[model samples]
Target chain A: MTLEEVRHLLDAEVLSGHEYMKKEVSKAFSCDLMSDALTSVEDRTLLLTGLVNPHTVRTAEMLDISGVVFVRGKVPDEDTIKLAKENGIVIMITKYTLYVSSGILYSNGLEGASILHN
Target chain B: MITIKLKYQVEKDDFMKAGQASSNLKKVLKQLGINSKIVRKIAIATYEAEMNIIIHSEGGSIDASIDPEKVKIIVRDRGPGIKDIELAMKAGYSTASQKVRELGFGAGMGLPNIKRCCDEFAIRSSFGEYTELSITIYHSGNNTEEGGE
Candidate 1:
């Protein structure tokens, strides 16, 4: 699915990389743990996380994650937003919890980042 | 036949800047035109090592040597070294405090994840002295499966 579709589905507000809204994402990994995200996902997957911090951005950067969806109505601090912008990562905020956000996307045919990679 | 070296000093408990070293390394590698897959592996390994120093050690440094064939990262930290290296290498064994967990880390997967990303991995530690990790990722001709995800 395209990031634009995800934005509409979750009612998410883009906080960074607005120009990349049409970016395509085939898989997503939802977790608060940076370690878990690092361990599991591959490059270009979307990260749905409630953990709002610079580390989240850094993790995305390391994994080449295409974008981050900040779930649970959480907003990242200035540093977090700055880092995401610097890396050209799309950052969005959603009012839904991580569970609901994952459900919405999954129900819409977005696959989870495969556990076989771990 | 040139090697680029980058060094970073990491402060203990400095959660604010824990991943800075790895981030900078990633940028340098990209600017140097390293393969994105190899750069990603190196960055992840180095970042995990950096976080281990900040979250567990007194302080440390990470040094990267990048060349045409491979990148090697050396992480050295002065801290209460691991008494059980084998146990520490386990997938879910972590000694991080609750505070660290609340921040979305200390899940005990750091070392294992680092190993997973490296073409060459070695770790050494003395219980009271320090711990050192040597991680190397080849630039090409690697056995790591690509496009598997």
Candidate 2:
């Protein structure tokens, strides 16, 4: 599904990259550990994590993620949002827990992110 | 035989700009036609090492050399050096200050992560003298540098 559909399904707030929401995303990864993430997700998949720090954006930058979905209603500060904007990454925030978010995306046709290659 | 050198003046113990050097090194490696996997490996390894310098030491600079077969990375800092290299290499062993822990890193995975990525790794730290890290990544021959920063 496209990022727009994911955003709509989760009632997410767009913090940046409004123009790129229509981009297609095949899978999603939910993790707070950036190191695990670096070696884990292989491609430009959607990142569903609650890290809420600039390193989240930086980690996505290194992995070339399609977008970031912050779980548990966490919102990025101005610096974090600015960093996301600078990297041209789509950002979404949801009130759902990580498990719930993963299940929702999984049931909605978003696959696990490991299959995508970096 | 293309080589690029980008210099960044890192401040002493400033965590905000810690990733700048590694990100730039990644950019340059991409432009140098390095493959994405190798580039990512080099980026992660060098970035973590550089962050250690910024978070634990007074600060340091990174020097990268690109060739057709390999990428060599060197990070050096003139600060309070590591007191125990053996202990430091153990995962979850950290000498990071309270400020470093607040950033979600410095959980003692820095050197181990670096070791996991590079083909060749060397570290030397003198007590109250300095710390320096050298890492090299050999091209796995995929040949496409396409990826994000």
Candidate 3:
């Protein structure tokens, strides 16, 4: 689904990068840990998490993630949102928990990249 | 035909600025007309490693360079050298503190991720001295039949 569809489905508010709503996204990965996403996330994936930090945007930049969804109503500070805007990563704030968020996206056809094991 | 030297001082315990070094490198690569996909791979791999150094070491430094042929990133830290390189290289081994883990790092895959992305990778460390990692990825090898590209 595209960013617009995800926003509508989750009833989320676009906290930043509304321009990126037209972008297409295929897979979704939910993790509170930045390292796992760093190791495993792949092309055009959507990252669902509760952590609020600039590293989140950095993570999307490195992995080329489609966008970032802040689950459980977590809202990042100004710096974090500003960085996301600069990096051009689509960002949204949703009230759903990580599990619920992941399920909604998954049921809607988003996928995780192949499990990369050591 | 040119070489650029860049340095980043990863401030200790500054989780907010974790990937600045790698991001700057990515910016430079993009301006140089490096392929977007390849730059993404390099950015992720190097940034992960850079974060590890800052959170694990006592504020380390990264020295990076680039040229027409490829991009190179060298991350050096004076933290206690990995007590066990083999275990550390494991996907699940991490020495990062609880706080670091809370930021989503210390999964023990930093070294492996760096190795996976670059065409040439090297790591050297001394117990009391420091740990230095050298990574080189030829632009051509980036997209070859090598999986991602």
lDDT of 2: 0.79
Q: A1-118 in candidate 3: lDDT tens per residue?
A: 8999999988999988898798888778888887778766466688889988887878888887758999999999998889888888888999999999888888888877654555
What lDDT does model 1 reach? 0.88
Among the numbered candidates, top TM-score falls to: 1
lDDT of 1 at B43: 86
**Candidates' chain A TM-scores:** 0.95, 0.93, 0.95
For residue B22, model 1's alpha carbon misses the true position, in angstroms, by 0.3
Model 3 residue A107 CA deviation (Å) reads 1.6
What is model 3's DockQ versus the real complex?
Answer: 0.58
Compose the digit string of candidate 2's lDDT tens values, residues B1-149. 55555666666777667677878887777766777777777888877877777777787778777777788888888899989999988877888776666566766777887887788999999999899888988984757755543
> What TM-score against the true fold does each predicted structure earn?
0.94, 0.86, 0.91
Q: Write the per-residue lDDT of candidate 1 for residues A37-112, one digit (tens) a residue.
A: 8886465699999999898999898898878999999999999999889889999999999999999999999999
lDDT of 3 by residue, B1-149 (tens): 47878888887677767788888888887776677667877887789778877877777888878776887888888767776677777777777788777777777778888888777888888776678888988884433322231
Measured against the native two-chain assembly using Cα atoms, what DockQ does each of the candidate structures obtain, in the order listed? 0.61, 0.31, 0.58
lDDT of each: 0.88, 0.79, 0.80
Work out how many backbone clashes candidate 1 has.
Answer: 0
> Fraction of reference contacts reproduced per prediction?
0.62, 0.11, 0.66
- Prediction RMSDs, each to the true structure: 2.6, 3.3, 2.8
Q: State which candidate has the highest lDDT.
A: 1
Question: In candidate 1 chain A, where is summed lDDT lowest over 10 consecutive residues?
Answer: A109-118
